[model samples]
Target: MLDLVVLVSGGGTNLQAIIDAIDNGTITNARIRAVISNNQNAYALERARRHGIEAVCVSPKEYADRELFNQAFLDTVDAYQPGLIVLAGFLVVIPPAMIQKYEKKIINIHPSLIPSFCGTGYYGLKVHEAALTRGVKITGATVHYVDEGTDTGPILLQKAVEVREGDTPQELQRRVMEEAEWVILPEAIQLIANGRKEA
Candidate 1:
C-alpha cells in the first residue's frame, strides 16, 4: 500500500471523498497516513480524526513568515513518509522546501477546467465566479500533478460540468464538486496508483 498524506485548508469534502472511495474499493493500495492543514479549526482535521488518522495543524500564524512555516510544514509531512501527497483543498504552496523532494509525487484538485479559471488568486468560489463572468457554458474540475506553478501541473483527469442558466457561484461550485471534483479526484488517485504518469 502507498502511504498518503493529505493537505487541506477548509471543509474537506474531497478528503472525505477519498476516504469513502478507499473504503469502497474505488481507490485501493493507498492509505491515508495523515492529514495536515494550515488552519487549526479546519473541519478537514476532524474528518481525519473520524477515520482514526493523524491530523496536524501547522498554523501559518504560529510562524513568523511563509518561509519558516513552509519548512515546519514540510517537516511535519515528511514525518509521515508518504508516497503520495494529495492537496485536497490545501491553500498554501511549499516551494523551496518541498518542491524538489516531492516533485510529481504530489497532486491537486482544481475546481475549474484549469487554464481557464485557475492560477494565482483563483480558488474556491472565485473560480466559479470567473467562469460565470466569462459566460462559459462548460466548466469542470481537474486533477493534476503538483508542480511549481499554480495549477500548471500535468493533468491526470478532468470531468466537465454544465453551466446552467441563472447559476450562482455557490451553485456552480457545488455542482462542480458533486459532478466533477469528487468523481475525478479519486479516479485520478486510482490511476496514479496504477502508475499512469502522463500529463
Candidate 2:
C-alpha cells in the first residue's frame, strides 16, 4: 500500500476530497497514514479523526524558533514513513531540509494554474482575487511535485474552471475547489500510487 501523510492548515476541503476518494475506491492501493496540521485547532484534525486516521499538530508557535519547529515537523513526518506527502491547503512554506529529504515524493495542490497568481503572497482567495483583478477568464488548479521553489515543481495534473461574470473571489474559490482541486488532487495521488505499484 502507498502510505500518505497529508498536511493541512485550515478547513480541509481538499483533505476531505482525498478521504472520500480513498473510501470510494477512486484512489486505490493507498491509505492516509496520518494528517498533520500546523494549527492545533484545525478542523482537518477532526476530519482525520472521524475517518480513524492518525491526526497530529506540530505548530511553529509551540517552538522557540523556526529551526526548532522545522526539526519537529520533519521528525513528526518521518515517523510516519510516508511514501507520499500531500499538501492539501497547507499554508506553511515547507522546510528546506524536509524538501531535500523527501524530494519529489512530496506534492502540493495549488489553487491556481500556477506561474500566475502563484509564488510568494498568493494563496487561497487571494489567488482568485488576483485572477479577477487581471480579468482572466480561465483560472484553474494544479497538482505538482513539491520543489524547493514555490509552485515551481513539475506539473502532474491541471483542470480549468471558468471565471464567470460577476463572480466573487469566494464564489470563484468554491468553484475551483469543486471543479479542479477536488478532481485533480485525487487523480494525481492515484496516478502516483499506481506508478509505484507498477514499478
Candidate 3:
C-alpha cells in the first residue's frame, strides 16, 4: 500500500476527493498518512482532521531562511514516512534538498494543460484568466511528477475541457477543477504507485 502525504495551501477540494476515493475503494491498496499545509488557516487541514488524519502546518514565516524552512518541512514529512507526496494546491517552491529526498515520489496537479499556461507566475485564477484571454478553445488540467523546476516535470495525465466562446475565468476554473478532483488526482497517484512497484 502507498502511504500518501498531501500538501495544500487552500481549499482542499482535491484533497477531499483523494480521501473519498480511498474511502470508497476507488483507489485501493493505498492510504493517506497525513495532510500538511504552509497556510495555517487552509481548509485542507480541516478536511484532514475530519477524516481523522494527522494535519500539520509548517509556515515558512517561522523560519529565518528557505533552507531552514525546507529542512523543517522535510522533517515533518519524514515523520510520516510517506511513500508518495501529493501536491494538491500547495503554493510554495520546495527546496532542492526536499526535491532530492522525494524525487519521483512527489507529484503535483496543475490547473492548466502544462507546456502551454504553467510556470512560476501562473496559478489559480491567473491560469484560467490567461486561457480565457488567449481565447483557447481547449483548456484542461495536468498531473506531473514534481521536479526542481516550476511545473516542468514529466506529464503523467491530462484532461481537456472545451472552452466556450464567452467563458469567464471562473467558468473555466470550475470545469478544470471538476476534472482535477474527479479524475486526474486518483489516476496519477495510482500510476505513480504502480510504476514504483514495477521499478
Candidate 4:
C-alpha cells in the first residue's frame, strides 16, 4: 500500500474528504500513515487521531530557527516513510530541502485555478476575494505537484466552479471547496494511488 502523510494547518476539511474517500473505497491501494500539522491546535490532528491514524505536530515554535525547524519537519515526515505527502492546506512555505528531497512525490491542493490568484500573498479567502475583485466568471481549484516555486508544479487535476452573482468571498470560498477542491483533490490522489500521473 502507498503510505501517505498529509500536512495541514487548519480545520482540515480537505483532509476529512480524503479520509472519507478512503473509508468508502473511492481511493484504494493507499493508506494514510500520519497527519502532520504545523499548528499545534490544528483540528486536523484530532480528525486523524479519531480515525486511528497517527497524528504529529512539528511546529516551528519548538525549534530555535527556521533552519532547525525545517530540518525537524523534514526528519519527522521522513520518519513516517511516506510514499506520498499531501498538502491539504499547509500554509508554511515548504523548505527547499524538502522539495528537493521529495520532488514530484509531494502534491498540494490550491484554492484557486492557479497562475491567476495564486503565488505569494494569495491563500485561503484571499484567493476568492481576488477572484471576485477581478470579476472572473469562473473560479476553480487545482491539484498539482509541489515544486520549489509557489503553485508552479505539474498540474494533476482541475475542476471549475462558476462565480455566482452577488456572491461574497466567503460564499464563493465555500462553493469552490465543495464543488472543486473536495472533488479534484481526491481524484488526484486516486490517480496517483493507481500509478497514473495524469487524469
Off by over 4 Å in 2: 196-199
lDDT of 2 by residue, 1-199 (tens): 8999999999999999999999999999899999999998999999999999999999999999999999999999999999999999999989999999998899999989887789988998899999999999899999999889989998888899999999999999999999999999999999999994221
Please report, in order, the local distance difference test score of every candidate based on alpha carbons. 0.90, 0.94, 0.87, 0.93
CA shift of 143, model 1, Å: 0.7
Q: Once model 1 is optimally superposed onto the true structure by TM-score, how far is the C-alpha of residue 187 displaced, in angstroms? A: 0.6
Per residue, candidate 4 scores C-alpha lDDT tens digits across 1-199 of 7889999999999999999999999999889999999999999999999999999999999999999999999999999988899999999999999998998899999988877898989899999999999999999999999889989999888889999999999999999999999999888899888988732
Model 3: per-residue Cα lDDT at residue 192: 61
User: What's each prediction's TM-score?
Assistant: 0.97, 0.98, 0.95, 0.98
True-structure lDDT of candidate 2: 0.94
Quote the positional error of residue 168 for candidate 1 in Å. Answer: 0.7
List pairs with backbone clashes in candidate 3: none
Native-vs-model 4 lDDT?
0.93
Where's the lowest-lDDT run of ten residues in candidate 4?
Answer: 190-199
In lDDT terms, how accurate is model 3? 0.87
